[model samples]
Target chain A: MRAIWTVAIASLCAAGLATPASAQAPAQRLPSAIIMYPNILADGVFETRIEMVNLSGRTQDVKCHFLSPPTCNGTDFFIRLTPNQPISWLASRGTLGTGNFFVNAPPFNGEGSLKCFVVPDEHGIDHQNAIQGRSITFGPDGYTESIGAIGIQRLTPGEFSTTLELDGDTYAQCPDNYHFTFVASEPGDPATESELILSTCDEDLENLISKTTVVQFQIINEFEQLLSAATSVRCYDRKVLSEINSVFTRDTLGTPTGQAIVRGVQGAVIAVIVDKFVTPAGAPAVAANEPALSRGRPARIRIP
Target chain B: MSGSRLRGVAVAVALALACGTMPARAVEVDQVDWAAVLRALGIALDSWRLSPFPRMTPTPTIPVPTATPTRTHTPTRTNTPTHTATRTQTFTPTRMPTEPASGQLSFDPSTGIAPAQRLASALLIFPYVVHSGSKDTRLTLINMSNRNIGVNCFFVKDAGPVYGCLEVGFRINLTPLQPFSWFAGQGTNNPLTFTAAPPFDGVGELKCAVDPDLPDLEAHNVLQGRATVFDEDEGNTVAYGAVGFQRLSPGHFPGVVPLDGFTYDQCPERLHFQVLTRQTGSNSSIVLTPCQQDLLTQVPTSTTVQMQIVNEFEQVFSSATSFTCHSVKSFSSFSTLSRSTLGTDTAHLVLRGVHSPLIGLVIDQFQGGPDNSTHTAANDPYLEGGKPSQIIFP
Candidate 1:
């Protein structure tokens, strides 16, 4: 009788008729927020820096668009990035990893209509495949042929970095409020197939699941001072490193850290640091292989 | 000789007297004794004179009745009388009167109408009126007053029938001193014409009429009409009119039965209206009727609105600004809006912005389809549509 029951269960599984209780349950979605930091340059221009992180185990990709105040057009101050693209920088101990992207910033046009987006990566494209399970398929002759896995990192903690320069003289001439938005997503696969022990199949299955994050900051001359005195660092994912650990290893090279930090300005220099690593004591840490520290070089940005 | 003879006679008489003697002789002897007594008396008198002086005493002469009358006859003296005459008289004169001077006459000065007021009277249907098709459809203005008058006209939209219209400019003559009676249309065809009215006698009312078909000689429906009457002699009288027409056919009617031109005169200022029947459909005739009033009280001033867009990664940017302005005579209005880019992210993105004086304003409408490809999906993932924001005038 037990053997007969086992056969029945296997038949049910093979026919794609069986479903686990967990599948019917609703999935809890995570909340995300974005912060914008603006730095004023000497040439009367402005540079903006952002950091985006995933707070949930699900990985996410974020896109940002900036509009001048009076008219919020998509092309105004817009930036697109893949899952691995860094949104800001990180500082750990005495070491700092500056962001690589450069954004041109003008004075706020006075409309106060800026926005951004964040998308989840359930397939591990933003991180490595280690945190998620990998699958391998063999040919009919028994020779191993293909290997694949969901590439998204469930980043409980992550970090991103980038810089923008704003025209200070222009800002002085027209002081205005800069509005911004940040969106988050947790995409899932819609074409996922039930596994058969002897069958091999490859499918492209990804859907967009997203949320929005919003923040506002005034453009003033003393913006850098406000950023330095901030107590809690604003980020989309405060524990972004944990989410990255689910899909990629600590030593993974070129993995993008997605985090966002927003700072207000009154016309001066502003710096943002996004760190994804944590120490043994559970404190934030900078990556050990950062280029600035490894090459023993000083990183300085001058705007004239 | 007489004395000797007398002496001889006396001697003879004395001798004869002595002889005759006695009394008679005494007399003759007295004569003789007189001489001797006289001598003796003379000697005694001389002796007596020595004692004084008793001077000669003369005896009184006798009475001789002498000739008084003889002296009077000889007196015949000539007497001459002299008389002088004096005369007295008076005189008088006359006078006259004078006169005074004279002076000239004067009247009240005329002021040009405001561009807004003119536009309010001219372009009654603004953006709704198709700007194309009839290039001959220009603007016309008329002043009903005998005295020369000046005015301006304009075009506007958005604020409904009352206040949204804006001014384009004024229509002043090149020579300022010369009183302008009429203005030609802007284009060669000159669809619209403006003229001053003839002066009325003994009345304070002036009628201004605008004829759209004047130069074209084509009859058209009047779009707007206004009239002004000076209640008092020193008051103002203004009149204005606008012309437009709705056709029964969709296409141009080369030769259709023309309708009688509508006439609106002696109307008051500050009147606004919309046409009740604007379009002509199948089996339906277009008609012009007065619509509602007080739709919009005042025109809008400078103001603005804002909007935002976001991507998969939480990054943001922005743009903000205002519209353009135009003026005609006494009215001014605005159009066009603009702004700059703002955000911390530095990546390629697209944005679009727009504004319309007719429909107010709308911001940021995402176009195209959702980008779900693996490459683009890996990049951006958000969509927004419709008017993302609004701006209102203050």
Candidate 2:
């Protein structure tokens, strides 16, 4: 099949719909990238399928690791993609279950996005950002929401982590800090979870995901006062953080209005995605009369 | 939005297939190998270009034959080509996914139904009935940017005959990351009072233009949005995404900004889609939205789009119309197509604009069974976006 395509190309240049390689402008090269999907769900029957494509000219050896343990990639898998090649899988599990296909990732009970930093396979130097990806949530309710991934230029060695080699000759780098902000949610409002992914960049097993950092969180209410005791996530193996002493839910008999801050230590940064889970079963039916409650609700598309 | 980029990928497939640069079909099949055609569709999706920045589900790929086939019949079974030196070519099951006389559709992962990406210029294709019961499209536009943005939003309704005018649409300023939500057909209660913008709320797509007033013309990729469609029956709720196409800088084009509009870097000249329905048991349809040529131009531009639907038998049933900016056309119910010769199972729909470009038009199948059980499977139309650089309106 490929051989025939090659001959056809030669004939096409003579026929002319497409400009010959020499005549056409040079194609854009993929850049060194820090591709992140803010939210990945693998809870119960729900799932998050991720699709990644490599449009670069050469093969790209990219490493992927989750911020926490029993990570979705199964201890961070490395994949090599040729130009224009696309590889997709379920983030929770490395691959899909039996014929229940159509899903790239399994139902990962957790919620947070996947973070990938693009670098040359052989050479550690950052490569052009050429990889693009998208993540979709398959809620048991049957509604499919396609939230594609976003690629931000990888942080320079100076902006985030230093070029550090933790295990073997393989490289390990981490962002020094990350801050997440979202409008406050009230009680009965679908509880909101601020999931931060801090993956193991190290590629060795003897190390067994040993790098650790203190992620201190501060909850500040609309009144600008501390709502909860100063709490910190103490761990070396937590990939995603969805509970800060049940911070996602409102305390006290009434709903509270405030924001929380999670400050990571130097050489300990991660991507944060805040999901407003549609009110859970048996939760309070929201009081619809007050217009104030609707202010910070997550924005969604409608059929107009 | 990735619609233009999706179109870009589609164009590559069609071009490669057209010029014989790539496989006319990936594997030679005795019949239309639905699975083989479906798998190759994602082959050209460059990870980096998968609807850059803010688009998803690029366009319904232009089917390119992956093989210089021993047979020459089917191509909707195609996409961008991949030239591999040595590879394992899996022979998927020849039988198509099982489909009953009616009720449901269990689709393949790559069915082109993934929610599409959002862009500065987008269209939310869905069904809306606001007459006796409550059926309205609640449109939401979010300015992902932290900065305030000025947007011109239109809620167009299908009048059965033609698309209503942009006369009722409104222009509002959105605050940093603010969301402008409204109930179409039914007036919204947001920045404005109880007023439903014109093409006054029937059932159709929504068009949003960023930076309506321009010299800077800076409002192309800054907006991302979606639409929650409401149907007559209470349980009829399907979340449809608005696919995006970018607004290129005037500089991309020499003087004039040209009437047809500068074709996108990844735009395709044509597009194709597939449709299905089992008798009247399924209500299958495809909605076609027209990408604006020079959207802001007060001088209305027009283009003729020839849309044809061909069934399994190779019989053709088509419709052609000239539309200005902000108009949409829909081909409803393939099960009962205009040409009965095409039969009842599946139909191939092709959309070609004489001058402008077609967006990611859609085809959805909806129905209610004997037990009053309602099932809906709507996929973003499989669009093959292929066109010259400019999708000029006039």
Candidate 3:
């Protein structure tokens, strides 16, 4: 009976239903993309799986970097994909035990995020335009879902900058102004966190080439009132994990549903994911980010 | 006794028994037959002696006790938004949780849908429980297109009309990659519209209709976006995601199509959802919430929607008829929905809408300590074919 259903799903997957694990956005050419497993548990209870596919016309070089919060937990690995080849990984536990291990994002107690992009290197094939991917996380009491990886199109000339600089200034000049918006705090209660995903959107960097950028911030209350702060960002693909209240209340901004205006001294490509985490009962935790293009799409402007 | 003597004695006893009367003393000598019995038992005694004894009973299934419906419990998150700021984002934050843990997610903000000739529309369906002890649905909707688009939203309450269709709906416009979200309980949308709907003290669904405008002179790519839905209560928490439907329509550009070429009239031929219904002093159950998207258009009163529940043994248990638009039903072990026994097991939730194409969600959960609760929601299977439609804006 189990075999029957297993085979049924397998065949159906081949025919239709599971056709696109991530309802891929239509594109003429494959582009660089970022895949996140977001929440993972390997502490014996919950588990997370990442499915990656080379949806390009040629073989590709897949570069994956695992980022954990609290203490800048970072690791990197490479994947070689023939055209249309697919691969799956056990979050940070690596490629299912063969040990090419690289993720330590979870089981440390809470949640973490990961970023992946396809780029050519001396060791692997040249860039595969874009990689279609999905992340599934499940455990005993929570829900499991396979979500499509968010895609970051290949950066065009000046589309994204690593050093905050003037819009038309040379790469060496200081960024007139660059900041990412995030809603980290909520209202009423003060336990929920407004987590942030600070990804390095610069996919075409030199091999092992890493750079650092200074960041400043204009924290705002729910009233859109300005507050204070900032941090140093390493383009090595890392996460900025912080509580909304601590970062946005009387100590920071003023209330739960406040905003953070993250300003970079230099220009760089970055994507911010503001996830709201809460466990009113204190045991099981869940996050819900108000559906808003508040973070990913940064406004274009010139800062003095 | 000697081996020869024992055999001879056994033969004598057998002959006496066959002759007519076998003495009890004859059976007392039966112990001597142990050696012969071993030889007669034949087949691989060596292997049998080495092998672990197999148990006689089948796997013991965990029995799930029916949950005494509770009306009040601490929810993971609430919908009632406080006045943190005179003004907040479209999707406002209602409460702060117990703790703030670090987190991250690499989203494909633009990867779900492709350009299609059809005036394609995507359907975003989710379930919510807003009663005293109820759960709420928190979700995010994104517009992946570079051009402006509009979305029509509908709130389908879990109960029938006597409870008032409970559907409070409205529309919103998106500029390029705009995202909008809110808690269904307190209210969503600008004027706090959903707050006006009846108190949906039960489970129900939300449907958002993507672009309903058909293609103009120039062929254009349709809108696309990513969705994340979280089902949480103070003790229980579950989260999953569904990308907007991608239409693999056949034509010159046979790759991807939305809204089946943007055709206004469309419905899935069949839908299948795998669910886990755990029950007990330990809280487990498979929740199947099916809503008929075309309810408002029903004729002569209402339409009958039948859902057949099939267990692992191929046994089918069906539900009572559903006339109204939405229904949130639960089937677990030892419950009225079971065939014989109700323990920890898996089954398929099957049903179809008579006149309207249906949308369904399946959640499996168990209530426990420390961690409070655990649950998982599986993916929806569009077995027959994709059956979501574009919305007609009011």
All DockQ scores = 0.00, 0.03, 0.05
- Cα error of candidate 2 at position B315, Å: 23
DockQ of predicted model 2:
0.03
- 1 or 2: which has the higher TM-score? 2
Off by over 4 Å in 1: A17-304, B1-314, B317-394
TM-score for each of the candidates: 0.14, 0.44, 0.45
Error of 1 at B19 (Å): 99
RMSD to the true structure for each prediction, in A, is: 55.2, 25.5, 26.6
Per-residue C-alpha lDDT of model 2 across residues A138-224, encoded as one tens digit per residue: 543233334434333221122223232321112212222222333234434444333344432222233433344455655543223
Q: What tens-digit string does per-residue lDDT give for candidate 2 at B145-175?
A: 4455666555444344354333245666655
- Which stretches of model 2 miss by more than 4 angstroms? A1-39, A49-67, A70-133, A143-145, A151-186, A189-304, B1-135, B142-150, B162-167, B175-178, B189-200, B211-214, B217-224, B230-287, B292-355, B361-394
> Chain A TM-score of model 1 versus the true structure?
0.20
Give residue A16's lDDT in candidate 3 (0 to 100).
38
Superior candidate under TM-score, 2 versus 3: 3
Candidate 2 chain B, run of 10 with poorest lDDT = B86-95
lDDT of 2 at A101: 33
